[model samples]
Target: MNYLRGEFDLCTGCEACLLVCSNRAAGGYNPRLARLKVFRENENLINRPLVCTQCENPFCMHSCPVSAISRAEKTGVVLIDKEKCISCGSCIKACPDQMIRWDKTGKADKCDLCAGNPLCVQYCVPGALKLVKKREVPGK
Candidate 1:
């Protein structure tokens, strides 16, 4: 399965990823609206980027009361069906990483990997964030 990976050592805390991601996801440049988060650790020594892992057993997907959230079979990406969403915020609460959140429309929103070409990865000048594929384990 493909997922976003973050390397703290390579991160410069520039937040370029956040800017582009928010613009793509929310139609704005606000970092607060980004689907991913960068946390400063150890007195600003480390900038740890946190993005949706698109878990094999995603808590966000299971927590949706209306079944608005689902994993795309082809790409293995977790997605939200806006038409079926009820704005209940169950997914938000269920996410351990806090990747899911309320959008301007008051509905659940998360990263969709920019339709397989993540702008965050493209804009990460420090090479902190990357989209990578992992081999699925046998009989997991």
Candidate 2:
């Protein structure tokens, strides 16, 4: 499986990735609606892209009362079944990385890897975000 990796060193904090991601995820242009978040630290010298790690044991998935969230078996991507979602905010609170967000419609949002190719990776001019095969390390 290939998980997306974000590099803070190459990030310029331009927020182009956030804009595109928000539009795609929320059908709008609000950064707050985007699944991916950029955290600026060190006086904006570092831009950390906070995305869903697609964890082996995702808390968001387990926290959903209605089973709205699930992992895609084919892609290893975590996805939300919007119709099944009741907007209870449990998944939002369960996320450790704080990547899940609330869209204007009040539904929880998170990255789905854009079904395969992520727009954030495509538009990242600085090469900060990348899609790479998962490397298995001993005991990992």
Best by TM-score: 1
**Candidate 2 structure quality by residue, lDDT tens digits, 1-140:** 67788888998888888899988977778777777888989888788887776777789999999999987767778789989999999998999798788867888878888888889999999999998886432221
Assess every candidate by TM-score: 0.94, 0.89
Model 2 poorest 10 in a row by lDDT = 131-140
Per-candidate clashes come to 0, 0
lDDT (tens digit, per residue) of candidate 1 on 25-140:
89989999999999998999898999898887888888888989887877888899999999988999999999997889898899999888899999998898999996662321
